[model samples]
Target: MLVLLPPSETKHPGGDRDPLDLAALTAPELTGVRTELVETLVKLAGDVPASRAALGVSEKQDDEIARNAALWTASTLPAIERYTGVLYDALDVRSLTRARRARADARLAVGSALFGLVAATDRIPAYRLSAGSALPGLPTLRAVWRPALSPVLAALPGLVVDLRSGSYAALAPVPGAVTVQVLSERPDGTRAVVSHFNKAHKGRLARLLATTTAEPDDVVGLRRLLRRAGLHVEHDGDTALTLVVPAV
Candidate 1:
């Protein structure tokens, strides 16, 4: 099964090894768009004020622009290692066993604003680009991405579990993908959409899915595996899942 994850804004900086090689990233078809976006970002970084305005960052974040400015020359880390946020913190790939880590690289794909989609092991540099950011010459990111990314995503060989948030999901829609939603189950047996714990639950779920020996080729098997991992999961029709966790 293929599990798609969303990239986080917070990242670890200054990798001392390697540079981004678009050909080395999975999905060879994305090279054109990747080159276009990377060049646009690097150019934009030359004008700090314009970059800040376009990226929706405050004056204090000029360092972010510097990161983008060195897009071509900056040191790189694997996609999983670079991202550091609530979700990634919970996924914590570094703590996984060697076998699980190998599985993670094979099964996980990160939905990215800059690179479209990258495998967990893809090498990338620190840069500032969110789904909402509009660069100087490009159309809406959704417009720039959907034409290429959607078809690539839809053609994947097995069950696809999409765990991306709205903006990133908007970049490319996977028609047959089964999506997971995190919910809070209250003491009174009430259920509500979870905000704070959403990323954490999804992170844990990603880890579980990545490590499982069972190959869940469809939603039923997916749900079964999740349940076996001890998550409170509910099958929501054929297209979605609800993972209920205790409210904090």
Candidate 2:
């Protein structure tokens, strides 16, 4: 099974001397668009004010723009290690055994505005761009990405568990891919959507799926696996699963 994860805004910086090699990333079909976006970002970085406005960053975060300026020559880190936040922190990839890490490398892929989609082991630099960012002289990111990314995701094999947030998911829609929703179960038996800890829960779920021996080919099997792992999972529909957690 392939689990699609959202890229994090907060990333661990610095890597080995090797720079980003677009051809080495997964989904070679996206190389053209990736290269286009990267070049545009590098050019935009030359104008800090424009870069800050376009990327929705403040002067305090100017380092991010500098990272984009050096994108082509910057060192690289594996995608999984590069992304860090509540979600990735919960995934705790650094603690996984070598065998489980191998499994994660095979089953996990990240949804990126910059790269389209990159495998867990894909080496990438720390660059700043959001799914909503609109670079000068280019179409909306959604417009640029959907046409190119959707087809590639649609053609992937096995069950796809899409855990991307709304914006990234909009970049590419995977028809028939099982989607997940995190809900908080109140003492009154009513449930509401989780907000603050949603990513944390998804991260744990991703870790579970990555390490499990079961290969769930469909929603039914996927739910079974989560249930077996002690999560309160319920069927939302044929193609969606709801994970119920205690209200915080």
User: Which regions of candidate 2 fall more than 4 Å away from where they truly are?
Assistant: none
- The list of candidate 1 runs beyond 4 A from truth reads none
Report each candidate's C-alpha RMSD, comma-separated, in the order given: 1.0, 0.6
Clash pairs for candidate 2 = none
Number of colliding residue pairs in model 1: 0
lDDT of 1 by residue, 133-167 (tens): 98997899999999999888888888889999999
lDDT of 2 by residue, 97-180 (tens): 999999998999999999999999999999999999989999999999989899999999989999999999999899999999
| TM-score of each prediction | 0.97, 0.99
